[model samples]
Target: MIKHSIRVTPNRKGIWFIVNRGRIWLSAKRELPQGTYNELILSAEPEQFCLIGQLGDQDAYLLVNHDHIANEDEWVTPRELLTVSEETFQLAARAVQVALFLQTHRFCGQCGSAMSLVSWELAALCNKCGHRCYPRIAPCVLVGIVKDNQILLARSNRHRAGFFSILAGFVESGETLEQAAVREVKEEVGIDIANLRYVGSQPWPFPHSLMTGFIADYVAGDIVCQPHEIEEAYWFSFDQLPETPLEQTLSGQIIAQLKQISGNKKAT
Candidate 1:
């Protein structure tokens, strides 16, 4: 089990995830610092110490250091760890999200009182009005609408030309994953989808986002891009697709799966 907001000593030894601002401190090799707390030799005193989880036999901890550890090789965002081992990436994600949660949730939202960490849990309690807050995780849906050998790819307004990916949007307050998929597809590309197949999930910690992926069959509607939302969207053949998301991303995985399924059908 993972421990949060725990006390630790400078002599404590383990893997360290020293985070500052939104980036994490790393060695020159772009790897997390490991060893005893003092051996890590942090430039600034950490605002907090959290035992995120266990990495193998060693305990993994996050040092919330808000100071800007100067130099480019000193820090990198969690995105840099995408190509690393899944276990390492997960630990890095947890570290950053927990740090961000602690940094932002210092003050109570409802009562405007200083919040203190609960001794035995990952939450902050506002003693003034009994308000409690946990780390916020925004749930997002990734819909890969497939129609035979083609997959629908879209370039959002935020993306530049040539790059495209599957449709994605945040889940609404009272909607299922399937509902969110259908709604996001329709609103983003004016398409209808069905036969939603659950794929997998990935923790994307750009300030804490959980991406749930799905593969749905295209049902109807034309590709009419939403103004100021989607730049361009079209059904691209698996054989001849333009630039898309990397294989490390969910959209990329979905596209690759569609292509693989198509290849299998042809072989059969």
Candidate 2:
């Protein structure tokens, strides 16, 4: 059962780091400690990653990168990000996720008091008041709306100019994740869906969000993209599916399953 799923790597201690200008670097091999990374102390543990900011950035927490790095630039030299594995992104994302929460919760929502990290737990303690704060991740439902023989997808203004993604929205109060899934499809693409099926989920910590994926049958209505949210939307035939964007994620997984199921039905 677990053989096909993504596995996360554990963070170990005693790893030497290279702090070039500002960013930190992790070596490729466990024993190879090359470059200026050896000079800096292990400020946080292996799982903890740093949130870079200006002076007096009290809200910043740490994030750890164990995966092989993917992107490395001179100015934002992400040594760890460059050398980590694909599976490690989940761990790194989790670290940054906590930091992202801390960053946003540094100030008290109740009394505007500055919050400090709690040593015992993953929370912050307010200085002026007794309020304890923690990070938050807004829940969102991303769905693939399918009809007779096609799936509905749209180009988002939220992403890069030409990138298209599944219809999605933040889960509103009093609504279950499933309800949100149906509502989001209606609000974004002006379509109703049935046979709501859970696909999978991803930890999208670009600030913080738990993206729940679903595959729903398009019941009716024309593809009317909501303004400010969706720019263009259309149903593409399964055999003639549009060029899917890069990155294998929850959305990608949903598409893969859809293709498999659709194909099996045709054969039978």
Candidate 3:
């Protein structure tokens, strides 16, 4: 007698991030569409795509949808995903950045030849010129200055009254994250800081930025807001603070840490 047996496997779902003209598609429930084409909410097939990462044992793909104005309400910017869980926010960050990279690096800068995606890595290569390009990430620093139980905050010229955050600036060509933090604080508020402590880092996808946070001790100098940059600067007591970034952001995290260290109530 002969016996045969068949084994069956469950089909896991993949998270699809459909992007059109920089905006990502969300389900009516306002969530990333999961599964393959069967679960994809959009109708257009992608002309470009990238496997970003895995989420919950399922793969996550970045699909570049065609440029159109259909279902406008379903397409939301990455900023809208800030309230989502950290995992979702992270995938969305990579999706948008990768999409931007694919869109911008379609041609070789050296030979003006068409670029194609590399099979083994997240990069675009030009066969003619042998040139390759990868996603760009700008490094930025967020410095939360502390004096006694007070924290130094500033409102940039671009910010409205009331909303303020820790001092932030981009890392220059030859500058380190620590150097950038100190220089940003000094340039924006005309102050000196000592005893800098590394706090944490966050992926800020406002056009691709990695924010490295630091807690610095206020050493000297008065608040002299830089023109054309800082609208105002002040040191506020931990208990009484103005509007600030959300708790999901690095700035907010550092602020919460500082308040906890001071044994003060959490900021609203």
Candidate 4:
């Protein structure tokens, strides 16, 4: 089973954190310092503070601001936290998402009134309009297209040179996850796919995205790369695949699964 170090809970305070823009303040040991939530809340004001969750035995609090804290020993981005540990990355991602949500939804959209935090849950309530706003999670699809021992991979213009991975795209409104996968493959590489089996999902919080994974069979059409999105497209043999993303991502997970299946067939 997967282990999570941080647990979601109602507002309480034991450990203090300050977030400026997207960077988080960390101590010399690359850890969030401990401080009283009550004191921090009083000084920082309730609007600037958010109760993220419980980290082990302490309650984790986040202070969101546009200005940096001079008292902080070090400042690091969420990507930097990934280098420390998976648990740290998870916590940092969650914190950043919550912080961004709070920052963006400071006022009610329906009514021009300041919103208030709804205790016992992760949401904001507008006293005037009674409108509740929750954190946003954009759903996306990542697919690995396999044909015999070859898997279809594409290099996107956004990715670094010498890196390629599975086809992916954001799910449009009123579209099913399966439909999104099929559409993404068709649009990016100009091919049809079948047997789109669901593999797994991963929370990719570059800006709060939940990526669902799939493995599909190549159906028809030659690879005609999408003009702006795909830089190159190719079907790679299992033994001659290009450098891809790490296993921590859904695309990597899909590729790893295909490699294992290909290896098993070769062995048998």
Candidate 5:
């Protein structure tokens, strides 16, 4: 479905680039412009570059340590990229992930040997010790617990004031996604949950994380916020909920879903 190639063609308009230090260099309009790699006037050729993938009819490339090319172009961070079109955002996210992978995989961890990119795949190969490494995608679980017309939300100590979100944690080794969901919920809020139904998944590219979402019904236990983790935890009625995450995130999506389900139930 998705086409990817290593070939670079000259005379094309300009290439979309994920440039230095995990930022995207694009037109000043904050959009993907029509262009080719040949049109870019760089101070020097990029030391590291990879053809990430074809976005629509254009090829996007990820370049490391790129020199500033034009005054009309602006560099945007990954978070700012999310405000653009969904297609552009997804492309930029993928480019960032690839760039980060290349940056950290230059040397083999096991043999201390220099590693080279494998031509046919997205991986690093250590010729000396025959070690190969691929981009890491950490799996995380996000769970929304619903009880009647009220939903459980928590404020993490790390978040800014007034921001609340559902329970979430990274999946540890040798644990199932369901197990992680339950454990995270209990450990973070001191509550028990059951009927963890798979809701959805999102590719969160803050250095490559795959968030798997789940919705669970509250079974038992009173709220006991974990120190240094959850600053506050409470069950808020649907109409009286506090400030939550943006709808673009999995946590916000799950919360919206819960609201819709509750509304329908009340209507019927």
Candidate 6:
């Protein structure tokens, strides 16, 4: 239900945004009011901009391509921006999502024509052609594989320390979400999974992704980490699970759920 639910912070905070010939420019909310109008970003920013309503709240995130953060390292973990509220983080994440969508879809794929923002609705329309492009959410699956009392998880080469997660991959061209989950497990760690059951999903707007969650039982196979993709793979007993990264994300939720289920089974 988290996908259907987003937190609305408080009020409107000015976000200074710019688009040069339709490319987003980033600037702080304070600096944006004084700059030329193009595209704008209106989201939650306690120190920079005011906290605003949640995304899908009938308020469009005015997206301007401006990088105004004091520290470049701070941009990686977006939840640290301004106020620390779920709603605020959700809004900010969606803002990044919208900006990324617009940036990538600026040009029409079919005819290679320039695209313009639609007057009504959050979509881009081809200036020369009549093509309408909407925001894209790449469908992916995250699975928790459990066998006996231990659970299977992997650490990606891209993740920070202490950040391990369930096996995940993008839904392929002609595969179902469940199929993708199974295939990802095999490809990432050479493991076979069974009893794939849907748990929940999250709108990971960090560059626009919808992560579908599943819990699968480990059938067979050894811990063989995929090269370049997964740095390490391991089986952690119920009593020895590693620390899970919790940034209000789907991966975090699945880890928590896995631990809870394992604990209950041990208790009974």
Per-residue lDDT over 1-268 for candidate 4, one digit per residue giving the tens place of the 0 to 100 score: 1112333233344776677767788766667767654434223343466556666777666667656566544777777665566666666777777878888888999988998777667788999989999889999999999987999989999988889999999999999999999998899999999998999877667688888999999989999999989999899998998899877656887999999999999999
TM-score for each model: 0.95, 0.71, 0.89, 0.83, 0.90, 0.74
lDDT of 6 at 119: 48
Cα lDDT of model 5 by residue, 3-114, tens digit: 2335545664435664666777766566655666676655676767676666676666666655665652477766666655556666677777777888899999999999
Candidate 4: C-alpha RMSD to true structure equals 4.8
**Tens digit per residue, CA lDDT, model 3, 1-268:** 0001211112435787888777888887878887655555445556675567777787777778775346789888876787877887778887887788888899998999999877767778999989999779999999999997899999998889999999999999999888888898889999999888999887877778898999999999999989999999899988899999898888999998888877744433
Model 3 TM-score is 0.89
Q: What is the lDDT of candidate 6?
A: 0.64
Q: Given candidate 5, what's the lDDT at residue 75?
A: 76
lDDT of each: 0.87, 0.60, 0.81, 0.79, 0.80, 0.64
Better of 1 and 3 by lDDT: 1
Candidate 2, 143-193: lDDT as tens digits: 887776677778878666555667888999898999999888888888888
Alpha carbon lDDT at 197, candidate 6: 86
Q: Which stretches of candidate 1 lie over 4 Å from their true place?
A: none
Q: Give residue 160's error in model 5 in angstroms.
A: 0.9
Give lDDT for model 3: 0.81
**Model 1 worst lDDT window (10 residues):** 1-10
Model 6 clashes, total count: 14
The TM-score of predicted model 1 comes to 0.95
On a 0 to 100 scale, what is the lDDT of residue 223 in model 6? 85
lDDT of 3 at 39: 50
190-241, model 1: which lDDT tens digit per residue? 9889999999998988679999999999998889999999999988888899
TM-score of predicted structure 6: 0.74
Quality of model 5 by C-alpha lDDT: 0.80
